[model samples]
Target: MKYTKDHEWLRVEGDLVVVGITEHAATALGDVVFVELPEVETMVAEGDEICVIESVKAASDILAPVDGEIVEINDKLVDNPGLVNTDPTGAAWFFKLRLDDLAVLDAFMDEDEYADMIG
Candidate 1:
């Protein structure tokens, strides 16, 4: 798994990539109440604000890890926001992308480095 200092995780699956907030991030965000996802087929550049996750305390922009077109989004989050706080690494996955540049994946932090960053 690749990670970001901002507490997002990316894992490649075939030609697509799955993205979600890290456990630490979800915990910090508190009870999530809403999620805003980009429409499928939307083109996103690396570092683009592709989504927003709103918690009871604040709303956070979810950045893209690679330049890609959005292929899918987890619509489950729209109805069950607690999944973000309860299972951030699994059920709370926000979206998938058909990445254009795999090299951009190298810009993210590794798990250990990201853990340290969050601490």
Candidate 2:
């Protein structure tokens, strides 16, 4: 898994890449009330806003960390957005990407570097 300074995370699983905000971001968002994800098969560039996560405190854009096609999304979030708060990095992952280039992940920081930056 890799993390971006914008708080998005990516995980390469075989041919698919999982994407979500960090636990730190979920905690800061308070309670997530809704989610808006792009349709499957949509093409997105790195840093493009592909979804919106609305929380009690604020609404935030969920960015595409790498150029890719959106293959799937966490439909569960539409019905139960709190999953974002409880499991931002696990069951609550926002979407999966068929990454354009796996090497793009290398541009991100590791967990230790991200933690230090936020602290």
Best by TM-score: 2
Compute each candidate's TM-score over C-alphas.
Answer: 0.93, 0.96
Looking at candidate 1, the ten consecutive residues that score lowest on lDDT are: 99-108
Tens digit per residue, CA lDDT, model 2, 3-34 = 89999888888989999999999998999999
Give the clashing pairs for model 1.
none
What is the lDDT of every predicted structure here?
0.89, 0.90
Which ranges of candidate 1 are over 4 A from the true structure? none
* 1-119: candidate 1 lDDT, tens digit per residue: 89976688999888888999999989889999999989999998878998999999999899987778898999999999999999999999999989766767887888888877877
Q: At residue 85, give the lDDT of candidate 1.
A: 93
For every candidate, C-alpha RMSD to the true structure in Å: 1.2, 0.9
Assess the local accuracy of residue 35 in candidate 1 as a C-alpha lDDT between 0 and 100.
95
